[model samples]
Target: MEISQRHEGARGTISPSGSLVAHSSNSKLRPATLLSHSSIRTAAKEVSTLKWSSDSANIAIVSNKLVEVQAVEGHAHPTRIENGSGSLGRFVGADFVGRHHLLTSWEFGRAKIWDLSTGKGTDLGDLKTTCDEPAWQQRPESTGDIRTVALLTRLAAEDTLTMHFPELSTSMQPLKLPTVDAKSMSWSPDGRWLAVLDTATASPSVYFYTPDAHQYRSYPSAANLEGDGCLGVKAINWSADSRVVALSRYDGTVVLLNTITFTPLAVIKHTTTVEQSNLPPHQQTPIWREAVSASNERSYALASQPVSPPLSRTKPTIEPVELGVAEASFSSNGSYLATRDERMLSTVWIWNVATLAAHAVVMQHSNVRKAQWHPTRASLVILDCGEGIAYLYDVATSSAPLAVNAPLPGSPTLSWVHTAAESKLAILAAARSSFWILYPEGAESVSDDARAGVEVGGELFEEGASEDSLLDILSGRKPALPYEIEESYTKMVELEMGEADEGADVAFDDTFREKKKADTDAVDPLDDSQIF
Candidate 1:
């Protein structure tokens, strides 16, 4: 194929025949927006649920009433596993081995090993779905509530992956559980531990399990959970480093737990009722005036006003921040964390992992269901904002996203692959029949320094910081300065108006001159000579 190129001096475009044409610019692509998209459909069945493994190149989608598997690089057709029919198919943690995943099908009353590579599934069996233990049957009065069903996996020393399903002993058939209707279950990144939440109990306990050793550990989170969690935890996401797992409870509490030891990191208190507390002494100040007794009957005017009855405590309605922790995800590089609220306001919260403090929040209109940091450009992240739209957000700028990229074939599971050689591609589970293809529009080929600049916007403009600290602020956590917002907004407005302004046409220029002359003709009392 003969490739043709045309250069238009400082600004230009080239169309090459049968070859990918490249554009080089002294400045990065303006707006850095999602220009266009193509559609792809999945062929298995309607994908009701899906899970993307961190390490693997496959996505486990529960379709056709079975667990459907597709390789990240594979074509539209998925290897369908017909087992787990009529069961609530759950994608548990993927094993350390190749594309093997731990799947729990509530209908089958068992967890299964799904070999994505072989398109096969092995039943690991069930736990007592109900708390119907013989010990309880013997002493009916003392029978406690059997709460949850969980599946945990551990890789043995010989590399064989073992799955654990907690059981309640029975006489006739061991009354194997129908499977635990868990509130939430999360696996550590290394796949060494699993955490389960039992909402059925009076005080739900967070259980930890290690399948390799065939052991179960429970946390002491016996906080009398009040609300009936029938809908249970909507979502759960582990911190990038796997040191923390954020859980979103139905009752509106986003619980953060240290993964190593089941300890509460912070119980972020949230209530629909916005309460106003008394202002601190330093913050509360009253301006006063000196009273003068002029005559016998002195009239004194109050100068500084008394603090207005500490603004009436009105219930400020803040959107429920806790929408079940599962709705959030950590960046591949572990620099930022993101989640969405009940009101559909998706927030990308960039953090300093070392300090665990939030640095920035990228607010979007749609309720974001999934988000991941670009594997190569750690500061570049993409979000699946439910309703067919996906957003590519540069964690660094206040400018609204360059452009909102939509997944083809509609709502598909979006994921990222961080291979050493692969271009950071967005794998979207296409229309239940295909996987939509997405590649980084502009972030793919940029250097880390350039990417960092895009990620942090103008944070690099600050003075007196070390190179390391500057890099951190550019790609890490640095509160945005007010100027950044104005600058980004200005740039966005300019981009919308078109980067290269054609200048005013003759007719427009004539109108502009007339308007200018009319404005100049307005009366000026101060200087008559200048006014004329």
Candidate 2:
């Protein structure tokens, strides 16, 4: 097959025998280059989810009945495992336990660890746990080892969360939760805290717990205060440092809380002005007349009809209405927060963490499917709007987001793969026939620099600073530094001298010219007698 590659300014297209083509438009930010595209056949045509191994060498694609593990670096045959037997039920989800082992869960709260090397599946004991979705503790620093996994199970007429250590084959004591209906759970990046979101309560709350199943505190959502009948949190995101947590509520507000002190920091409300659809009398009268004429023409029309007055002409007024937040996430360094509202599906709000102000607003033509920050780079975000294009926003580099089109057909889902050497993105097309991996050009050095900039005194700058220090700095309550004081004094003195010099020059020059002109005029007036 003949392959053709074309480039026009910031845009690029690749065509292979007209079967597949990839297009990307350049921006101030670097565009992702299509590295590899591969097609694989599966028993099921749809893909439920995609996950990358910690090493970034393999990817696990889960379907309804089977799990497919594909290698990224080679042309190796994909491994398919169908562990769904009599009581095991269907495969719900799968996560990489390590580089060689894969943990697959079932609908009946059963789990199995499949060894990819030997093609062996070992089932865990009858734990009767709810494995609908398991939240694995993230350990970025570890060597792809399964540490602790949290699973939910209904016990004693209430939903209970339990921890299981896969390697040791032991489970932790069941932790009693405040709400019986826990919507979801998330572990901090450092694996220090676990946050469980409870939506099935009078007031939705987010409970914080230690890794050892110790409940520390809970923050009840403010959604019920609007008298909206127990609105819940749609999403929860923890800052990279695990210090601040953002809760996206269904009441159109995002609450940011200080996890250290368990107090609210700010409540961000997203409001949009909508024009009322009340039409003017002139416009309504024409439509009413047309309808009346049409009704009179009908053969079976009623003889008596009620006459209705036309509405008075008035200008439409715009009123701001709050929109529920659909998604919210913090950047890698916690410098920026990105949120998407449910009503306004095509717009993204990027807020500055330091100033609590909007840094950028990204509007797309299509509804956005996902907006995720880079795993290692701060202020960089990737958005997929199901338009076969990926929009990238890097606040540190540019104000405008860049667009990169996928090589495959249909809407594609995105997953970021971070490795020791570089970071890559996996785009799975909607058809599930093929997938592509893209690597952003010139992103490695930029990511390295961003990671280095956030580290201060051998600890993350966000985690090292105390709450009081940050509050004082943000509120402008700190004392001025010596250099700042001296600089202010110098600037004040310079401004005063400059103004005085300008005033003196104008006054002296004007006074001297006026005196000279007066003297000449007076003499001329007296000497007029000689001419006579």
Candidate 3:
């Protein structure tokens, strides 16, 4: 099957089988179009396992846990310290600071500051309630109130560590803010300000904190919210210029706002019901309904316009956009945005700063999340598509994604190192929870050519196999796995919208409601009179 993608003026179309069509005014895409064509295949018939290192990468994934850290490039992975009987909270977020320090925080009540260059993890302190010390210039009394902290380390070589420790601040401090719960957090590109999603109020609002002054500023006020219906704010992305912020709400509303003025730039709404109609004649375009009628009247009258009769309307359906698993990320250049839904499909969308329509739905991933742009290049992106698979895509051409056959002994997470002088290579946290330095096949590198080549083929040795046997079995491999199978799958069958309807506007009546009601009502096997 040939897939064709095309751009026409402000809107773009993807013809999965050379038949798809859509219309839009703003460049930002509507979710309806994304769902119709952005179906990614989740099944990977074949996969490979990977090696690991924890210190050299920013993120790590194992089993159901994800770890984010800024470990030294050459040091051994830092030892994890467990305190009390509390759970060991998986690392949720991490960032490198000035090339020397790695900071981490978790959903569990703990945060740590580590020296990445020396592999020294200093418990610069815990946010636990017992450590509060007004005498030590530290507020240990406020530990339980803390929820999440956003750490910022501008460069790996920098000396400062900035953290949004609202939960640990004492009353004597100048900025005495409420006990806030952070749902999301981000830093300005320049690293001067940190923005937070404050869920402490009836209507959650974004708050800004300046590290130097230890003060809080409320830029966006509560009056701006439309209602409680807007509360499902799941994710946020920052513009590269630090002038705008894009937010995603669970209700399917994606909005871009002016960071300085706190004003909405555009709001992209989503819907699932397909609205079908015909276009008017080439000479004169009529209203949608009139155009449909005119086409049916002219049996063969060769009208100049192209039109078709209207089909019956159907009830508008709302397709659920997964709230929790989807994350918002901005391209390095800030010209576009990308997100992955819970269903395993990811999309790169062109962002029009002025209007909200998505100009193009660049590509989709079948089972990937965590996508980021090449720090020095404009078009390239890397993503982990679960199942030990990863992909690199060139946005300019929405063709087949470039496959990166890295071994992910198990599920893995990815992180990018920013490079000022060269295109940075991705650091993949290996299956052992360690990190590996990976350079794509054609990417430039200065390492010695004597290094071992990427292991492209292998078979997992049985439990009874020896180490030497395993090494010899997988070494110098070709068509390595004799038991592997190859097969092709048909493209996803389009979910037919609205059942064979009385008209296009009608909706299907659910039949299970009565059954559920009978189950909860008085036990009656003979409710036949009310069965209808």
RMSD of each: 28.4, 34.1, 23.0
Error of 2 at 329 (Å): 1.7
For candidate 1, the per-residue lDDT at 349 reads 43
- Number of the candidate with higher lDDT, 1 or 3: 1
What is candidate 2's lDDT per residue for 17-122, written digit by digit as tens? 1112222122111112333222333333245666667655566666666576655444444556644233456667788876677877766666666666555455
Clashes of 1: 18
> Against the hidden reference, what TM-scores do the models get?
0.44, 0.57, 0.45
Give the residue spans of candidate 3 off by over 4 A. Answer: 1-174, 178-180, 212-220, 271-325, 341-348, 352-356, 362-365, 387-389, 397-400, 403-429, 432-440, 443-532
Q: Report the C-alpha lDDT of model 1 over 1-532, residue by residue, as the tens digit.
A: 1111112111111111101111112211111112221112233244444444444344454443444444433232334444322333342222222234334344323444444333334445343333221001000011242312233222221111223322222112221211243343455665556555544442345566653324354544445443553444444567656777766555445566777666767654332222223655443222211122444221212222222211112355664443433355676666666554443334444454545545344444444567767666666777665655555667655443433445244465565534332443433333433333345442355554443322111122121121111222334344323212223322444565663456543322222334446545552121111000
User: By descending lDDT, how would the candidates be arranged?
Assistant: 2, 1, 3
Q: Which model, 1 or 2, shows the larger TM-score?
A: 2
As for TM-score, the candidate ahead, 2 or 3, is 2
Question: Which prediction has the highest lDDT against the true structure?
Answer: 2
Ten residues in sequence with the least summed lDDT for candidate 2: 455-464
